[model samples]
Target: MLESYSRCWTEIDYAAIAHNVEEIQKLVGDTKIMGIVKANAYGHGDVECAKALQKVGVDFFGVSSVDEALHLRQNGIHDSILILGYTPPEHFHYLIEENIIQSLVSYDYAQKLDAYAKEAGTKIRCHCKVDTGMCRTGVIYQVQEKNMDQILAEYRMEHLIVEGIFSHFPVSDDLGQESAAFTKKQIELFEEVCDNLRKEGINPGIRHIQNSYGILNYGDLKMDYCRPGLLYMGVTSDDAIPIASKPDFIPILSWYANVSLVKWIQKGQSVSYGRHFIATKPTKVATVSVGYADGLHRLVSNCGLEVLIHGQKCPIIGNVCMDQCMVDVTQVDDVKEGDVVVLVGRQGDHRVTIDEISRKSHSINNETLSDIAGRVPRLRRREK
Candidate 1:
């Protein structure tokens, strides 16, 4: 697993991913767990992580786009794949070819898809998304609402099949009581919609609304399927996971870089491209090969952000460049070029977690993980 062949790379633990899936399965009990593998599996390498979950019998997989679903199919992932977001009409054929489930967010999109499927002489599986609160996608759960059949009007029986109905909870993870009321209302609206659809003789096959935070906080609610996004990646950014969760989630990705060059700057010497970090004293600075392009936010420069070198915390000294950054390592003796530098994850007893990185960058784990550029190679650790 120690392939230091690149200036910057990330190591993904397959065993930890498998462990997360098993634990999530145990948490939700009989409810189907749809592993959300969107955004490259939250930047853990989508196909690799999905394969690991698939090996352990993951109930389903959710992706954000048709291209992502196609990537999984091309990699031989034949499991049930659902597009969590909308699929433009142009890419509708790809969905038909793979038999992947599409999400119907609007009546017009659904109608067009139904007609296209009818002409193709193929049936399409899909889930109807209801907008409980988050106004991004899905049908609004309120007035002007047409029943399921009316929304899906003229859908040839053989052309389109509504396999599930779902809604997204915008504030499900909020700890405050106010957010609680919002979540509850969202759930009630979704249920009411489902009931109205059923009364109208429309089948809502598998019902799911809970995301990672929702599952952690409200898994007991009714639902045929639960989407496990971040939690399945062993990243616990939610409050509920800490309060009463049994599973031990270990971060599966560790970012690393090599000290490509080492130089000693005189006292008062500025580091890197800016004078933002002026050395207070004569110090030895190590040029670690990682930068904003590799996902290290430039905002972290001079933020007292530290990376791990020789299991010691070394402060980032200046502006994070496009391909490199500098850190003061004068306190440590015998430091040299090509030493292993850890940007995230553990280094001996000292560790840098996604939480720490996110705090420093002023962003969430989702952005922190996915911001990792594609240029850096991902090293998958299978056995260990």
Candidate 2:
């Protein structure tokens, strides 16, 4: 059995991450890969995962903010990093000082960043973001003439070097006819904007429009780079429709906790805080050393959530508490305190996946993974 000094911990398979990178490489023949390490590699430990990715030849990284990018740079990552989201104008100097590329979200934002960079007597590298259809960020692509003028103004900024242009796909993962058509239009619009820039004697240094889903469903699109987040993490959302040619990616994260106490409960006795669960019969209950505070979602309590104990599925008996939760272990033979409990990993013939947890919690895989608190230590594992 695995033992941890902490209440719970996550085991990261570096080998599996490397294998997933290789699989992504196969799809994107010569194009560059921007390993999205934002949100601490989706709560898989950014620095460690970034180091593992660097070992596999991923030279470019995408982060959500300047802090995340700086975190990588400070941790000995010398690779090129682009902030895919907003960065305060006050931190524009940091981007230039750190040689980190900032995403030009809007023309106004660009002007503000340029002003800061100009005052600093330096130029900040940037990737122009076009709102093709996501309508979230970036300069709107619907107004082509106005959008072209705005992007041209950004490229013309002396203190801002627009080194690349990219956009997002809102529904590229959905292969249904309507959704697919909409995605196609988004790609076309992004390309058209890039082409327009080129026509104005401006070099849109690196043109990339593919995200994780875009890479999977439209891998044939010629682009200079592809940013993959969830795909690189080796798991997709439970609702994500899989393509026939989807590469085989190994899941890289496993969560485990130790059984803290074991006790038998009489019939009609409830457990935990709320009297939500009453023992129909004499049942054995084991309190796990993990709960909501440990990244175990309280929503999954009594919602068909189970943990593997003695290689058997034990049902969560009551409402999950902040620091602990109880699970019925009557069916498990010889289950006792100090036993290893598989919260989100394989145990014998059974495996509880992130997708399973997401489904039970009525959330997405990204939330389920990133919701894991920082208190849970992420230990790296290289499977042989």
Candidate 3:
């Protein structure tokens, strides 16, 4: 028998992962894919997601922190791990020893890394990040032309190897022509930087610029490599931008919980905190043992969100509690204690997607998935 804890669990479909990888691979043919598994595979269970992605032939694992990389290493994930976020200078030695790739955004930081690599007597593989107008991370574009050249020419020591050059698209989701123009500008600037480096007798390998949105909408920007994060989880940036010819994606994660209690709430009685829901008619309410604390956004309270109870969609009543939520199962006549309720994922012909939740919560799909905490046990789905 399945453990009781499995009643409230996440089911990850490995085959879906393979399908998504093949789809993206076809989209960016011959270019390598750096599967962004940062934020614990965007809250889909990091070690397991990385393992599944590696099985599907992901070329590299991208993470945000040293600790995240170490977690992958601890799980026996030995593939090339790239720490895309800023790593403190003090942690350079640790990055060097782990054989993990790091992104350098500043010349001074690059020099610090060079000094450490020289002391260690080994060449450190590092990628140079050009801002290209993101204004978030990386070296700003206006200064990059001169500063990048100096970093590669003067600041670079014998022990530091320039492995890759990349930039990010700030508004790939905004499909307006202006957004396209800006993206084109960034890509052009990145290409010019590469050209300049080559002219100076320095070849920084793996020039990449396409992100998840860029990979789908802008085929022209898919260069030597593509970094795809959210697409791996079957989330598209914009519904208006059609991805018609690609392989169909299956959402890998499913959220489910069993009914802890089933009873009748008298007419006029309210449910949950703040008495947000009042029963005009007698209501059959079922309490499920999972709530906002478990990563269900509080915004889902009394909104358009619905869950499948006995394969029928039921409205969520009142405010969702920190550890529990009540759903009006009035129409699901057969629902009782111990019946299964699926908050996210398929149930019969009905389904609830993270996209739906995101729309209701006025939040991004990436945040919705990644915020599902350690409290939820992820059950690995077996092959049929």
Error of 2 at 145 (Å): 8.3
* TM-score against truth, every candidate: 0.94, 0.96, 0.93
Q: Write the per-residue lDDT of candidate 2 for residues 1-384, one digit (tens) a residue.
A: 345757788888876778898888788888888889999998998888889888888899999999999999999999899999999866777887899999998999999998888888888899999898888889898644347789889899999899999999989888889999899888888888888988999988988888888888888787999988888779876645666356988888999988999899999899988799999999999999999998888998888788898788888879999989999999888887788898888899998788877888889898999999999988877456
lDDT of 2: 0.86
Q: Pick the winner on TM-score between candidates 1 and 2.
A: 2
In terms of TM-score, how similar is model 3 to the real structure? Answer: 0.93
Per-model CA lDDT versus the true structure:
0.82, 0.86, 0.79
Judged by lDDT relative to the true structure, which candidate is superior, 1 or 3? 1
Tens digits of lDDT, candidate 1, 72-147:
9999889989998878888999988898999887777778888898888888898878877887777666544534
Report the Cα lDDT for candidate 3. 0.79
lDDT of 3 by residue, 1-384 (tens): 133465477877756788888888877888888889999888877788787788877868889998898888888989988888878877777787788888876666777778888887888888888788787777666534445655464225677777887888887666688987887788777887788778878786878888888787675555888988877777664343554245466677788888999999898999999998999999999999788888888999999589988888998889989888999988887777788888888888898887777878888888888778788887877667
Best by TM-score: 2
The C-alpha RMSD of each candidate to the native structure, in angstroms, is 2.2, 1.5, 2.2
Q: Deviation in angstroms for 122 in model 2?
A: 1.5
Q: Tell me the lDDT of model 1 at 183.
A: 88
**Candidate 2: minimum summed lDDT over ten consecutive residues — where?**
237-246
